[model samples]
Target: MTCMQLLLYSYPYVTRFDLRRLMGQKIKLTKSTIDKLPIPQMGARVDYFDTDCKGFGIRVSSNSRRFFVLKRVKGKLTRVMLKPYGVITPEQARVEANKAISKLYDGIDINAEKAKDNLKGMTLADALKKYFETKTLKPRTVENYGDLFRLYLDDWLHKPISGITKEMVATRHLNISNQNRKAAANNVMRTLRAVYNFANELHDDTLPPNPVKRLSNTGQWNKIERRQTVIPAKQLPQVFQAIQKLENPVIRDYILLLLFTGARRREMACLRWESVDLEAKIFTLMVTKNGKPLILPMSNFIYDIFNKRKALRENDYVFPGHGKTEHLIDSRKQVNAITQITAVEFTLHDLRRTFASNISGTVVGGYELKRLLNHSFGNDDVTAGYVIHSIEKLRIIMQEATDHLLMLCTAGKKINE
Candidate 1:
């Protein structure tokens, strides 16, 4: 057979004896040596070579460099280069080649088996797409997580989740903190911990404990003081009066709905008429940050506002818009509108914040405020699984709170007064 055919036929099966003979023969047995090598019938490649080595029984030449690759379980093939062409003697290559031959004879498909292993040490970016698929987070929340990963975890995402050290987390925190982003740094650490925890659950291995634990000790993670910007409970009447003077009926009802229900901006904007049960006096928000359907009882003002909205279409949203996903997209424009009319510098979110503020310190505990805001309490040993048994109590407080806002909006009600 021609040397080319010989090399093509035998490669990977080329024995030490065969190599010896070919090298000894001085016939430049390029194709002959390859033809004798024993390669898997299906996976054999033109430039590929695998040989037994001390640790790596199967070595594959990637880009013409010979190396010892450790492909454990089922994963992508990885290699450790043995020696440079001129650095290692041909005898060394032959010896290494023999080791690979030995491994093949032992009937181990290490290369192929390793190629099938689970994704370990994958970067954050590599696994995020998969992560996003199963998460039920709100769009804004999911976007925030994506932003954090893109901004902070670019270098570390590809790191095997198993290999992330506390030091690495601390270093990332330090870098972000040094950049005058203490809150962002803490958030990064928090995201890392959450991702690692998720990976640990998915992987069959134990995850390293969160490094953020140390951050808490160092006071790096601070309790963010909630912003309290709600129009006062007693200030709603004046606010309502001011709202009524606005010429746009849509803006009038929108601002009233927000002040009355204390609903999150997006939650109210995305509200479907189908999700509202006017007879039951409750509106259901299907996808909340806590991944639970939130049932919010409507106040008299909210019910009346919905009652006045003119609609007949079966699939019509309460608020329609061309913004993202067809719900009255964002409340920012409404916020700006209200600010221009009422001369207040508050965001729609600030309305929720105002709701929280007005409720707290007046027969409403932080825990109660959290419930109204649909926040999930931490899984503390003592607090875990403790259901909020105060929905009715919350409703009464919210009713009182909404009534208070009504008084504020109408307070200075004489048109321009």
Candidate 2:
């Protein structure tokens, strides 16, 4: 016989419940049997158990009734709530109870095992909730993480976080890479790595080391090429004319600001009116990709674009969203329209790269261009520490690049000279 059968044979007198009877047997607590039990008139829950089912019990109060399993280990009582009445039937509760009883008789503390199961219960979905609560992340970053989870780990989300294995991650990486979405595959693993990192911190002793760590050792990561596309000097004029002809004034100015400032799409997207100081010819960014404050001097042409936007100064955002958020996020439609009009076939970052290429070696030296672009070269460069470009100095360099770009674009036709 099993430990459950052995326990039921021994614990006959421990059940003192004079609960309603079920045929000739010790009333197996069910919906019908539970309804027959007396309501505890003192505003406390009344419990009833089946003599045949060792750990099963039905707890009833005036407001609610629940099924629970009670396991006694080392003379201490442990209770685990199975579910509400209609949620799980009496037969289901008994099945769960017998399982708990089997664990208890095997020299195991049901409470401790349940606690271990709780850590084991930490699903990827639950881990994400904990991660969002604990980590300070950018709003866009948090959204992207969720998208990664939904896209890649939809099947794994409900599984226990601890149950994720290295082999599983490896298979996923290979499968995703096969679809030709190399960057997305790499990003999905990186995002899961962050989730596992958070799990390690939260469940210090319980969670296994992150499974995604094997990707680097196994050489599973995809190689992504950095794009070096730029607008050739001759094509820029026609591109400018196409931008000016487009309808949305906001989009027209936004494209011009990006080309002129070389700012990231998100930085420009989340721009606030307070960050721009037209009089000082400077723009202050509170947050950058590197977590540093980047203050860029607005070119005279970019300053003019801001000057016309002053009429719509009632809102706090430079680009207002149609939704609850203040800033505009949907720039793809406008960008595609501009691309069709100009046939430039460029992304926002391409414009930023075009700015870097236009001025990097010509208008300014390589080191000064790094400062203007807000790129961090490692501290090993002793000469770099000493070289600092002021806003006024950068303003001059920026103006040179803007003048060169606009002069090429506004030339009306391609100037070979």
Using lDDT as the measure, the top candidate is 2
Report the lDDT tens digits of candidate 1 across residue range 271-298: 7888887787777876565667778776
Please state every model's RMSD to the true fold in angstroms: 10.6, 10.2
Candidate 2 lDDT by residue in tens digits, 311-403: 765478786667777667677787788778778788888989988888777788988778777789888988998888888998888888888
Highest TM-score among the candidates is held by which one? 2
**Global Cα lDDT for candidate 2:** 0.78
Regions of candidate 1 where Cα sits further than 4 Å from its true position: 1-121, 133-141, 155-181, 197-219, 233-252, 278-282, 312-315, 340-343, 356-404, 412-417
Q: For candidate 2, list the clashing residue pairs, or say none.
A: 237-409
Error of 1 at 217 (Å): 6.3
Clashes of each: 53, 1
lDDT of 2 at 333: 84
Cα lDDT computed for each candidate against the true fold: 0.60, 0.78
